[model samples]
Target chain A: MMRIVKDIMARRELLVMLVIRNLKIRYKDSSLGFLWTLLGPILMILIYAVFLRILRIEVALPVLVTGIFVWQYLAMCLGDSPNAIIGSTNLVKKAAFPRLMLPLSIVLANFINFLFSMVVVVVYVRVAGEPFGQLALLPVALITQVALCLGVSLILSSLNVFFRDVQHVIGLLSMAWFFVTPVIYDASLINKVSANPDTQFWLNFLFHLNPMTGLLALYRSALIGLPAPALYLVIPSVVISGLVCLAGVTVFMKFQGRFADEL
Target chain B: MNSDIAIQVEGVGKRFRLRHAGTRTLKSVALDMLRPGKRTVRDLWALKDISFSVARGKTLGLIGANGAGKSTLLALLAGTMEATEGRIGMCGTISSLLELGAGFHPDLTGRENVFLAGAIMGLTRNQMKKRFDAIVDFADIGQFIDQPVKHYSSGMYVRLGFAVAVEVDPDILLVDEVLAVGDAVFQRKCLKRMAEFRHQNKTMLIISHDLNTIQSVSDEILFLDHGRILGHGTPESVIGQYESFSRGVTTSDLRREWGTREVVLTGAEFFDDGGRETSKFKWGEALNVRLHYEATKPVGPSVFGFALSDENGRVVNGNNTQIEKVEIPGLQGTGSIVLRLPSLNLASGTYLFSFSAHSADHQVNYHRLDHAFAIGVDAGKRFEGVCYLPCEWRLDREGAKP
Candidate 1:
């Protein structure tokens, strides 16, 4: 693990260059260019807002907007990460570098896109008259989410080189995960639905099992000044994210040696 | 490991598993799990116990036929792939041009790709900046450097790739057939740069099927056949073995005779001036190819022909009695046609002799032998190029009269 870190640090410039190249290629021919980043999350927010309004859910639009954008960032990373190693087979076959860099760069590039779309989050926050004090914790929540995304990206990219069905599976998995996370709906509503003590205990336990549940709640707390989730939920989310990150690196390094041959 | 060694491979090998059905997707893997008997997996050894070493400044050329593990070995040396067994130790930075523009991004401009390629090759940003102009100048694709590389022609792409590879100034360079891409002038320029690198004492591992290129640039040649080292020695000896091996393969492939039996070619032999049958001759020596044929039936005026091909199976020279307008009378018995030359005029290399007997009008081929006889030519003195032209060069000083 130390060696992998050293190798990555040694090739940090290459990692940055790959990320920049990804961003450049992403925006190269498109006329809307960087605006497309914000457009995706905004569209999802608008669609969800209409559906929720039709259903007459009382959740605030700013909270949905923030959740949708963060989820969009994760979705994009997961969607593209599977092809990262396979797509760069040319480099993988010709040059020797830390293969971790390929998926890491994908995650980082999507993070950059997420950062660009954060402007929409700020606007929504202002329009909804949310307090600014909780916004100070936004970076912490964002970092945790990035770590989670990076971990998942690393695992999926390496696996996809050998099993291409991982890419398709991720597509289906992301949709199911989006609904499970508090993206289109608020978590407090679920809390209200499980009003009985016995049902509430199981519902909360099941919700907290999803790392993104606490992450989404944390994002809401930071962006819209919603009440923070309980210590049990928040701490487990952070711990799970860190553990996934470690496992991602471990699994990636383990399987990366076979990438060139499989690709 | 010796400090003087640039690369050392000790019993290195690579094994690959071949699945009958590609398990490259989750669906196939699941199917494979459910249908256990349907899965077929075979093992292929791409390289087996390959061991060799190169000193710090020497160039080792790997020559082999296709699927001979040359690329696999180069990839291992480049550290792009790990050996399934054994060890490879190396000293100094290694830069490889396994394929032209292997890592180039089509959407990025040539200038951007230069930096990207350089970074992948372990060059720092400042180092690339310092050499960026030199790389572009070497590639010589002016103004195209700013355009997206996708717009660049194949030649331009290869030139840029070669330029970046050489400019990295790696202590050890691994090249695998990328030089085979560009035009002749660019190839010469690359060779010149390689020579300059040699002068700077850089170690090089080159894989090429072009015998001339390998002979000219490599200090030593390693010959591979079927993933095993067939021979390794100085270029002359190893290349000699490779030539013979290739000739053996071609001859064995062409061993079957196919032609109408009006006349059967009984024998073909090479002779020196002394009339002694031999398969070896010296450059510029008197050489003769005697073809013996027996007419099975009454035949019209016939022509006996012979062709001489170099080691690469390229016909360097050949002629027939009909083309020479030497008519022969109708024959019903055995006869021989001896094609003699005062001087072979060919360079020192193996040549394959093929003979054919046919009617004067070339309507019917009585019997034809393809690559039937192989001959070796040894140059008496050091010579260059394909064939000796037998000319003299006179130098006159500026103040002196010719």
Candidate 2:
């Protein structure tokens, strides 16, 4: 583990370049360019606001905007994990460096996008009349999400090299995962589904089981006010995210040696 | 471990698991792994129990046919791939030119990629910053360095790749088969840089199927045949063994012959001093060559030529009737051209010969047979180097041998 860290540290400059490359290439040919980062969340907010107003649903603009931004970061990273190694086939087959950097770069690049989205979320809070008390906790929320996504991205990227079907599987899985994670709806909406107290508690536990459920709640608290997550949900979420990140590192290292052969 | 040795390999081998039935998808591959030693898995050793060591600052060359495990060996040395068995011990920073433009992102500009490439080779941003100007200067892409590499020509891409690696200052460098891409001018530049590497006392291991490159750059050549080391020695003897070993395979099937065929050479024959028709010649022995030609139609101002190429198909010597100022104007019908030589001055080695008959202006080739047959020159006089120039040795100064 220490050796891998040294290898990555030695190649950190390359890591930075790869991150920059991902960001630059993501919007290179698009006319909207980097604005697409801002445009995506703004458009999501506009669409949700218009619909929510018409439907008489009073979901705050900050909640909707922050959810979309944080979800986009994890979604984008997970969506791209299938191609992380396969995408840079030239680099993987030709060059010898820390293979972990490939997926890590994708994770880091999305984190950068997520940071930009945070700025947009802050703006939405001030402009949309949302409370700004927990805004100081933005760093904690962002860091947890990054650790969680890095681990997930690593596992997905390395597995995709061996199982080409992993690409199609990831596409389907991300769609299903998005729907379950409450990107468009709050986790509180589940309360109305069950009438029994015991059933509601079990349902809420299962809902928070999705890593994104806790992360989304955490991001909402930071970007807006009036949503302090339960201690049980937030604590396990942080611990699980850490474990998943460690497992990601372990899984990526396990498969990276055979990447040249598999790719 | 010998401190003077730069690289030492011991019983190194690579065994590739050839899944004959092609279990690529997840379901089948998982099943194969679950059930070990299945019929589908066959072990084919690409390289087996190979061992060799290079002393510090010495350049070693690897020569072999395709699938002789040359690439596998190189990859092992470069650490791009690991050997299934044995160990590779090395004593310095190593740079591999296994593939040029290895890590270059096509969307990135050349300037950005320079730093990126340097970083790929494990250099820091500060090191790359210092070497950036020199690398760009060496690549010589001018303003194109700022443009996306995708727009650059293939040669430009290669130049940037080679240029950045050159600035790396590695203690050892590994070069794959290509030391011969790009135009002639750029090739010479690459060769000059390679020579500079040697002058700086850097150890180099170069693998090339092109015998000319291997023989030229290497101090010693290691020949591999079917994953086994045939021998390692001076370039002369090992290449000789390599040639003789592959002799039974007959290179004629792959011989190249192309021409317009306005006139056709029916046959070509070589003769010795006593008028015996043969291909073998001793150093300083007399040689005679006859070209039998039949012109399909009348041709004007024709030139008959023969070129002698060394083992690498590099022309050692060539001459034609036009160059010698002997012209046959408005030739028609079957005829023979005989060229007589009083003595041969070529160094001892096998050489390939080709005969061509073309128009004097050289636009139209009536008949051109390339790499037709090989001739051997016996090491009669023990003369060294490419040519056996006529000369005598004498001691000019009277000195004491203390």
Candidate 3:
């Protein structure tokens, strides 16, 4: 890990160039550029709100918008990063450097986009009558989310090099994981559906088993003035995220020598 | 390997598992992992026991057919890939032009890509800032430096790629057929710049089919065949060995037979006046090509031509019996035809000669030999050009001579 950090420091210019390229290619031929970033979260929140209204659920509007924005950033990184190494096969085949940067760059680039979307989140938070007193903890939550995404992205991107089907699997998994993560609903609502013992067990287990549960709870605590997440969610999330990161980096470095040949 | 060698490879080899084509699946990988004995992993060794070293400031020419591990060796030197076995050590910074425009983003302008490529080659942003103008000037793609690289022609792309690579001032440069991409004028300019790089005593490893470039620029050459070094020595001697290896190759199917003529070239050999069979010729040496043909019909105005082609596929010399009107009368039986030249003056390295026989009407080509044999010219004495001409020089009396 230290060696990789050294490589990143030495190759900082290339990383910066890649970041700029990602930005340019994203907005190159578009009109009303960068509005799309805010539009994505807004549209998702609006759709979810309409569904919740039809269902007559009494969820807080501020919590709904916050969940949607934070969740969308995770979804974007999860979907895009699975193919990060495959997408940058150009650099992999021709040059030698730390391979983890390919996915890390994707995470960082989207993190920047997520930061941009925060303006919309701030506006919606104010309009929805959420207090601004919790704003100081937002950076901490954001860092945790970044770390989580980095770990998962590294794993998926490296796996995609070996099994390209991991890309599609991650794509589908991101969509399914979104619904399970309480993005547009509260965990309390699952209590109503917990009639069967199996259903109750899964609902209770999922709320803690999901790493994003802790990350989202942290965000709500920082931005929406929610209670701190349970110790079970926080401890497991950190442990799993750290293990995923270690496993991802180890596998990536082990198989990296074959990337040029395979590509 | 010598102590002064900047790069050394001792029995370096690389074996790649040739994955079944388009067979990337989680199940297959899982099965292979779980049950290793039942799996059949086809592997290809791209390099095998290739031991060589490049003395500091010396250029090594790596030549071979495709898939002979030339690029694999270059990648090893650049640290792009690790050798599966053995050891490779480089004492200083090494950069590779394995594929021009490799890391450039199509959406980036030429100027931006120059910085990107330079950075990938290990130059700092400020160092690139210092040489930006020189790179732009060297690329010579006027007014298009600000345009996206996707808009540039292939030539301009290569120019920009080469320009940035050169400006990095790499301690060792591995060039893989980069000189073959541009136009003739640009090729000359690139070669000139490469010569300047050589003059600066920078170590270089060049892989090229352009044998002339290899001969002129390389101090030593390694001939690779089927992933192993067949021979290695000074360019002149190794090229001779390669030529002779090509000379003794003969196949029955290669012997051509035409319609009722039944004209089959039974045997072909090149020799000098002494009748000694040889493929190596000194500059200005007497040369002869002997062909044995069996004819089943009487044919008139038959033309037998032999042309010499250099490594670039350019025909340097050729002559036909019809062109010289040295035709023999119609013969109904087997006979021999030999073309003799008083002097053969060609540059050192391999020259391919092909022979063909046809009718005067040019409708029928009875027999043709494609690249029948390669001839080697030793860098002995030379006046100029392909053929050396005798000349006399007179000097005014000097105090030392007196």
For DockQ, the strongest prediction is 1
What is the Cα-based lDDT of residue B90 in candidate 1? Answer: 92
Docking class of 1: medium
Can you rank all candidates by TM-score, best first?
1, 3, 2
Model 3 agreement with the true structure over A1-263: per-residue lDDT tens digits: 89888989888877877676776777677896778888878887888899899999877887888898898788888888877877877777777666777788788888898998887788767788887645666776787788778878877877787788887687678888888887788856666876887787667656756777767777777777787766665667666666766776787788777777776
lDDT of 2 by residue, A5-120 (tens): 89888778889988988998898878999899888777877887898799987776566777778888887888888899989887876677888999999999988987877776
> After superposing candidate 2, which stretches have Cα over 4 Å from the reference?
A47-58, B20-23, B30-41, B251-402
lDDT of 2 by residue, B184-220 (tens): 8888998899999999999999987777777888888
* Candidate with the larger DockQ of 1 and 2: 1
Candidate DockQ values, in order, are 0.72, 0.50, 0.61
Cα error, candidate 2, residue B115 (Å)? 1.0
Alpha-carbon RMSD to native, per candidate: 5.8, 10.9, 7.4
Q: Report model 1's interface C-alpha RMSD after superposition on the true interface residues.
A: 1.2
> For residues B136-182, what per-residue lDDT tens digits would candidate 1 score against the true structure?
99999999999999999999999999999999999999999988888
lDDT of 1 by residue, A166-228 (tens): 877887899899888888777877778856988987788678778898888888888788888
Query: Residue A258: error of model 3 in Å?
Result: 0.8
lDDT of 3 by residue, B30-75 (tens): 8789999866458899899999889999999988767888988888
Clashing pairs in 3: B345-B386, B345-B387, B346-B386
TM-score of chain A of each: 0.95, 0.93, 0.89
